[model samples]
Target: MLIGEVARRSGVSTRMLRHYDALGLVRPTGRTVGGYREYSAEDVRRIFHVESLRSLGLSLKQIGRALEDPAFTPSALVGDLIRWTEDRLERERELLERLRAVDASAPSGWHDVLRIVELMQGLDSASAARRQQAVLARPEGVAVPAELLVRAVLAESDPNVAGALRWALVRSGGDVVAALAAGVRSEDAGVRRRAVRAIAAMSEAPGATAVLADVLGDPDPTVRGHAALTLGRRGVTGAVPALVGMVVEGAHDVDAAEVLGTLSRDHGCADRVLTALAGELAAPNADSATRIRLTQALVELPGTTAREALRRLAHDEDRAVALVASAFVTVLDERCREDRV
Candidate 1:
């Protein structure tokens, strides 16, 4: 076949075929009387081979090495190609994700597109400070999509950046509750913890409460504990068990106690709160340290029930427990007397 016919059949352009011939990658087997280049069957097949390798992202020089080098091993070259293809695929996927985030933002113009792109890039920057600035310095008109914020929040390991991202999500405030709900279900313990923490930071009324309520049963104690603490502060009585459990486990037990105290102020749950604390204190396996922590937790609860529980605990068999409870009772009595006077 001639160069034109070869180009037509093999989809390799004539110019490229000539270039290949110049490079000795594929040379014509013969020439006609007019001195035009003519390719034999083997030459045409070699052309096809070059085109095939090019399709696999082989550079012309690499293709020359692959086709002409007598000792070139394909295994190393193929491995390199695989790695390069994988890298390209990863880059494409990331680009597609960025485009989708930009689309989700619903940018109105080029400026909006650029702004969103810059913000997304900043969020993905290597510096935690840059990521934080991306969140904190976001301009008023360009809204970072809540999905992006959710992703950042879930992956952010830095406490300051995570807090800023949560703040941004709260201000962005469109269907973020749903986005965060997915985070609460993540199998990664860190992601679930961040999700629940972000969800807790959101207002209780805008479906965050319901999602958090569902997350109360999350297998991760950190996730469940944060959710419960938030819910308790929001006056959701459903968090009582988890809150009481935190007191028992000494996991953020102080804050849990404070929130429980606030919940008990509702008057209806005061007895229940006091009872849960007293029960934890009275459990058979309750060690002296557990008793001491529970004794401390009691100071948060109000009403006569809590006072009476503290009074009984004040005389407990454990000397340390008695000392702590008695001291709390003394403080309570002084506060009561001051209130009356």
Candidate 2:
């Protein structure tokens, strides 16, 4: 076939076929009497082969090596192509997310779009300070979408930056509870912990209370502990067991004890709290330090049950626990006597 017929049948443009010939990628196998280029069947097949390699994101140079270099193995080159494609896909995904965030912000003009884009870049900066500044320095009255803040909060590892991101979410006044709840359910423990911490600040948000209630059973003890403390302070009685567990385990036991004391304001809840504490103190495996921590926690409870529990602990087997419990009982006695006056 002549060059025109070859281009027609193969769907390769004449200019591109000529370019391939110039590069020795697919030279014509013969010439006609007029000295025009002519292609044999094998030459047309090679043209198709080059187009096939180009479809796999191969550069012209790589395609030349692939077609002409008999020593070239495709395994390494194919692996590199896979990595390059993945990188391009990731970049595209990030760009798409940024565009979505900008659109969600409802930017009023090019200025708003540019500002949102700059803020997003700062949030993604490697420096923690820059990320924090991105959140803190957002132009006042420029409403950043809560979804963007939610993403930042979940992925941020720096404590200060994470706090700023959470604050920004709160300031945005968008309902982020549902998004943060998904983060709470993440398979990554770190992500779940960050989600829990961020959601902890949204206690009054609609659905936040329920989400936190569910997080009480998180497999991660840290996540459970944070959720428990937040719920306990919100006057949710369901957090009592986990709060008591924190006291027993000495995980933020002081804060746990304080919240437990607050929950004990209710007469029925006080009894439950007292009973749980007494059970832990009486456990056969309860160490002296554990008993001591439990004794300290009892001071927060209000009622005869707590006082009587302390009175009993005053004579405990462990001398250290006895001393601490006795001192607490004496203070309770003084306070009770003062109340009588």
Candidate 3:
């Protein structure tokens, strides 16, 4: 076959075949009377081989070695190609995400596009200060997309930058609850924790409460504790058990106690909160410190049941617990007398 026929059959262009010949990567096995390059069957096969390697991201130089160097080992080269392809794919994915963010922003012009890109780069910056500035410095009237903020919030490890990202998400005013819900379900514990924290601040967002409720069963105690505390403050009685558990375990027990107190103010929920607290206190394994924390939590409750519970705790076996409970009982009595006045 001549060069043109070889190009036609092999799908390698004539110019590329000639270039390959020049580089000695593949040379036609013979020539015609007119001195045009002619390819034998084996030469055409070699052309196909070069094309195959090129498709795998091999440079022409590397292809030359692969085809001609008998001593060349393909294991290392193949491994390098895999890594290079993976890196390129990752870069492409990041670029695609940026483009999607820009598209989602509905940029009015090149200026808007550039500003969104700048903000995204800032959010991804190595310097935490730069990342925060990226979120905080977004220019007036240029809205950063909530999705961008969501990605930043989930990936951010820096506490200050993460806060700024959450603030930006709230200010973006885009419906970010769905994206954040997905973050809450992430296998990464850190991402789930950040997602819950961000959602806790956006409790007013539609479905935010439901998402927090769903997270109450999260395996991470910190995540479930945050969700429970947030829900408890929202007056969702379902959080009572988790909140009581926090008091028992001493995980943010102070905040848990305060929220439990607030939740107990609801006439219907009052007994449930009191009962859960009393149950923990009555548990045989309840340590003195645990009993004392539960006793202090009882003072937040308003009705006689809390006071009665405290009165019982005031005479408890543990001297320290009895002292704390006795003090809280007096405080509750003073509060009751004031309420009557």
List all candidate RMSDs to the true structure.
3.1, 1.7, 1.9
Whole-model alpha-carbon lDDT for candidate 2: 0.93
TM-score of each: 0.83, 0.94, 0.94
Clashing pairs in 2: none
Candidate No. with top lDDT:
2
Per-residue accuracy of model 2 over 1-341 as CA lDDT, tens digit each:
99889888989999999999998899999998999998999999999999999999999899999988999999999999999999999999998999899999898999999999999889889999999998898988897889989999999999999999888888889989999999998999999999999999878899989999998988898999999999998899999999999999999999999999999995249988988999999999999999999999999998788888899889988999999999999999999899999
lDDT of 1 by residue, 226-291 (tens): 989898887899999999888888899899989999999973688888878878888999999888
RMSD to native, candidate 1: 3.1
For model 1, the local distance difference test gives: 0.88
User: Candidate 3 lDDT, tens digit per residue, 139-158?
Assistant: 88897778888988999999
- Write down the TM-score for model 3: 0.94
lDDT of 3 at 64: 94
A best-first ranking of the candidates according to their lDDT comes to: 2, 3, 1
Give each model's whole-structure lDDT.
0.88, 0.93, 0.89
**At residue 46, what lDDT does model 1 achieve?**
89
